[model samples]
Target: MKLTLTLVTIALSINAVFAQKTNPNYDPELATELKADDYGMKTYVFVILKTGTNESKDEELINSSFAGHMANIKRLVEENKLIVAGPMLKNEKNYRGIFILNVSTIKEAELLLQSDPAILEKFLEPELFLWYGSAALSEYLEASDKIWKTKY
Candidate 1:
């Protein structure tokens, strides 16, 4: 299954390159908000899931933990604490499991990440990313509301 997913990612990347060649410059339809400095200082993390062995890989625990992760994100959104959150597709390879979230600071972001069942309980090793972008940050946050509302 994992191998199949990897092949799928490779195929997707090749297609994306060709898609770009024809279009050359497709942009995100969402509008961007450009408080670049402020947003840049803020931290956005991306988690890449490592392997899950044995008991932790049990379907129930994996599903339950994912729920907890989403529940935590929902709570943060309700409080207006999260700027954006979502799973990322594999770029060119299929090590594709993780989420991106925007928080006020790296410390706080790490704390929130550690709260996730996968990380907190040693269920998986996750990677982190502090993304840098101009207005893209705002666009993602805006799109995120729609995603949360199930409009996406």
Candidate 2:
């Protein structure tokens, strides 16, 4: 009878433990304080592709609305939302600028990027893509983020 009770207790304890999720970085207190308890970290990857027409149109769009787009990016940075954005070198083929957004999901990132004024210039639709289960944001932001956190 004692052994049966011990086994039952152990089983109940195991079940309880399994029911709870454990992740060190998940700070409920911070999330609640910020009023973003429902949000979690996600990767937003923007891939720049080489297209004859899009390259030129994108350049014009960027030149035309550089002020507005930059202001928006700065705001996002102030809000602790903007991850990183920059263009790949000219030498690189098929890919150009990549912006990594630590946002809600792929869809959320897409929606956010769509707000980019330069993107609305009838170009290649911003020509971005979503990456799931990624090993890491491209090498640039990884290095930049490290430097960023160190500075601030």
Candidate 3:
């Protein structure tokens, strides 16, 4: 399943590259809003959430920790600090999930992550790095609200 998902991601990436080659149907205003570079890319803080060594055996603690963890995610999204976040399908390399922060600096991203219960409780550890991705990522919060009827 992981292999399949990886292949699908690769295929989609290739498709996007080719699709942009012909006519992008580009929007000049959106480009300005997103601060898109020549390649339509923008900087972000990429965070990898990994399983920490300090796991508690108590179910109650785990449940409470995860609840707060999710709440924090919602808060960040509402604040427009986090553009993307989701868990990985596989546990390869102890990686549990990811967070793509709409911030330019690691320090800013770290401060935000510090509020997560998962991080505080040692259920999750974060590794942050600078990343460049499609400027369209900056529009995800608004786009997601339009597409999904569910609210958190």
Candidate 4:
């Protein structure tokens, strides 16, 4: 049994080495434009928008703030600073949404978040973290723009 396990491990190791070979479709120019590292990944700032301490009963203020938040999102996307932004489904952690910013530092992310009206009004609070993900992620926005039937 031990000999069989050793043989299996050796086989897996050989497969891993073969899998690490350079991609046949590698595009150096695209990688450079996306700021991808050797592994085709880049640093980003991940933000979790959580329910804030404010419990304002004023509906008009809340609605206006959210409208401004949406506008801010649009501006950030156009600026190429926000690569991903979406609301989370109902969850136990009180997380309202998320934003994956095309930035390397928490400070930069904080500066970007300052433009969000919901955050300013204390309707939503942000928690930022450094994230590493595929540099090609922003490419999806182009295709996404084509598929949307209506603007929200």
| Reference-based TM-score of each model | 0.50, 0.47, 0.74, 0.85
Sliding window of 10 residues with minimal summed lDDT for model 1: 30-39
The CA lDDT of each predicted structure is: 0.59, 0.57, 0.89, 0.96
lDDT of 3 by residue, 1-152 (tens): 99999999999999998884633777888889888886889899999999987768999889998999999999999888899999987866999999999898999998999999889999999999999999888676777678877765
**Model 1 stretches with alpha carbons more than 4 Å out:** 1-35, 38-43, 52-57, 88-94, 143-152
Which pairs in model 2 have colliding backbones?
none
Highest-TM-score candidate:
4
Which residue pairs come into collision in candidate 3? none
What is the full ranking by lDDT, best candidate first?
4, 3, 1, 2
Best by lDDT: 4
Q: How many residue pairs clash in each candidate?
A: 0, 0, 0, 0
Q: How displaced is residue 55 in candidate 3, in Å?
A: 1.9
Q: For residues 1-152, could you state the per-residue lDDT of candidate 4 as single tens digits?
A: 99999999999999998886788999999999999998999999999999998899999999999999999999999999999999999999999999999999999999999999999999999999999999999999999889989866
Q: Which lDDT value does model 1 have at 115?
A: 68
Model 4 / residue 71 / CA error / Å: 0.3
TM-score, prediction 2 = 0.47
In model 3, what is the error at residue 87, expressed in angstroms? 0.9
lDDT of 1 by residue, 36-107 (tens): 342233345545665444355478878887678678767776665555555546465435365555554556
Measured on C-alpha atoms, candidate 1 has an lDDT of 0.59
Q: How accurate locally is residue 136 in candidate 3, as Cα lDDT from 0 to 100? A: 89
Deviating ranges (above 4 Å) for candidate 3: 1-26, 142-152
- Which prediction has more favorable TM-score, 1 or 3? 3
